[model samples]
Target: MTLEELFYLHNQTIFKYLYYLLNDEKLAEDFTQETFTRFLHYEKSIKAGAELAWLRRTARNLAYDHYRRKRLIQFVPFLQGHEEQEPISPHQWLLQQEEAKALYLAIRQLKLSYRDVIILRKIEGLSIQETCDVLGWNEGKVKNTLKRALAVLQKQLGGDWDD
Candidate 1:
């Protein structure tokens, strides 16, 4: 497929995935565009039938790399941006709900592995196979990680596993 077609089909999915992972719409948008940019850089090398996986893996890496760099530079004081803000998108609305807000905070507190599995499986609704592909894990590892991640989320949310 052409880049335009691929972007049309998968841009929203990639953006939502990054938003859930980062919890920042602006950063998600930035990384979403970066992900597509990186895709174009490596498009010729990517194998057939793996475009979505390629985008997701690239996006995930970019997000994690940004987090790593942010941590390293976080101690340095910086001025806030002076630009005007854009209107909130629908994904931002979900975080405004009481339960969702609480859950989001709790998930953010979890370890990266747990948070990633939870977001991939529960929030983004990726299938086991898809999640495994995005995370570069086997199915068994994905299932086990997801189970443990859910348990941690349940405890963090102050609810029982049955809830």
Candidate 2:
């Protein structure tokens, strides 16, 4: 495939990673663009199958960049207007309002380890191995941690998290 087509194929995954990390479409879009811009240098050398891994790595870097930017931006002395809305399908329409509220509360209610597992596994769609890579834990630790995370979610959803 051509270089542009290679980019188009993996772009959605990159944006998905960014969206899960930032939980904001605009920022995800920005990071997706930045990912490709940086990727241009190495695009010629990478094979098609390897592109997904490359994009994931780029997305990870962009996520960290975003975190650093947010820390800097938070100290700003001014405010900007809120973002406008986009139309949504019925399923998405529901999550647009209520899911954010419920998810915010649920994550806050979870223990830190449980919350991290849920975010990495469910939100970012990371595999068990990727979770281990990101969190620097062993496979057994990942499995046990994931078990506890799900149990915590079950308890939280059974009460405060029902939506």
Candidate 3:
């Protein structure tokens, strides 16, 4: 497919995935753009019919890199002030619904593996095989991780959590 077609088909999904992973809308937008930019550089190397998976993996890596940089910045007093916090947007306010906010916060508190599995399987509605492809995990690992992630989420959310 052409670049425009590919973007049209997968951009929102990629953006939302990044947003969920990063919990920063502006950063998510930046990473989503970077993900597509990298795709442009490596498009010829990517296999056909696997574009979504490739995009997801790329986005995931970018989020992880961002987390690493942020963690490192925390230790360097000089670099800390260089990062500016953006004002929260109206969309962010809309996310303040009690249950939704609680769930989002709970997910953010999870370890990376658990958070990723929950986002891909439950939030993004990716199938087990698709999630495995994006995460580079075997089927068994994906299933086990997803089960554990759900259990943690349920516990974190308490009585409000429904199966």
Candidate 4:
């Protein structure tokens, strides 16, 4: 397919794909724009049938660049003013939230290779080959990292994992 046709057809799907990776709607939109812009040049580099893979790789690199820029800028996510207020009895309402936060913390503490596998497999619901493609990991490495990540999470959370 021509690059224009690909962009026209796959833009939203691509945006959603990047959205999950970036976890920021606006940032994902920007990366989608960046991806398409880069696609114009990178399209010729692809060997016809490989355009989709090229787009994914280019978008992944762009997402990393966006995150690197965010890190350098010390960016904090913006929030609505009213949502910033603390609850009078946060313990009562925030039990689930606390658990989720704990889970996120545990995930964050993992090494990046392990973390990527877990996010792709568990959170993003990608299959083994998809996760392998997204992270450019071989099958064995992806399986090993996923195993290690789950073990880490299990050990860290202890019995809470069952809940």
Residue 37, model 4: Cα distance from true site in angstroms: 1.8
Q: Is candidate 2 or candidate 3 better by lDDT?
A: 3
TM per prediction: 0.79, 0.57, 0.79, 0.68
Candidate 2 lDDT over 7-110, as tens digits, reads 77878877866675666779789889888877787888766565665766677667767667776311111111135667668888666557555655656666
What is the full ranking by lDDT, best candidate first? 3, 1, 4, 2
Stretches off by above 4 angstroms in model 3 are 72-96, 160-163
Q: Write the per-residue lDDT of candidate 1 for residues 59-144, one digit (tens) a residue.
A: 98988898898873111111122336677777774554555557667776778888778777776678999898889999999999
Q: Is candidate 3 or candidate 4 better by TM-score?
A: 3
TM-score, candidate number 4: 0.68
Collision count of model 4:
0
Worst 10 residues of 3 by lDDT: 73-82
> Which pairs of residues collide in candidate 4?
none
Say which prediction, candidate 2 or candidate 4, comes out ahead on lDDT. 4
Residues 60-129 of candidate 4 have per-residue lDDT tens digits of 6787677777773211211222355565575755775666667777776676566667666776567788
lDDT of 3 at 67: 76
At residue 154, give the lDDT of candidate 2. Answer: 65
Query: Per-residue lDDT tens digits of candidate 3, residues 1-163?
Result: 9989999999988987886666677988999999999999999999999899999999999988887977831110011222466766777646644556677677767788987787788777899999999999999999999888888888888854553
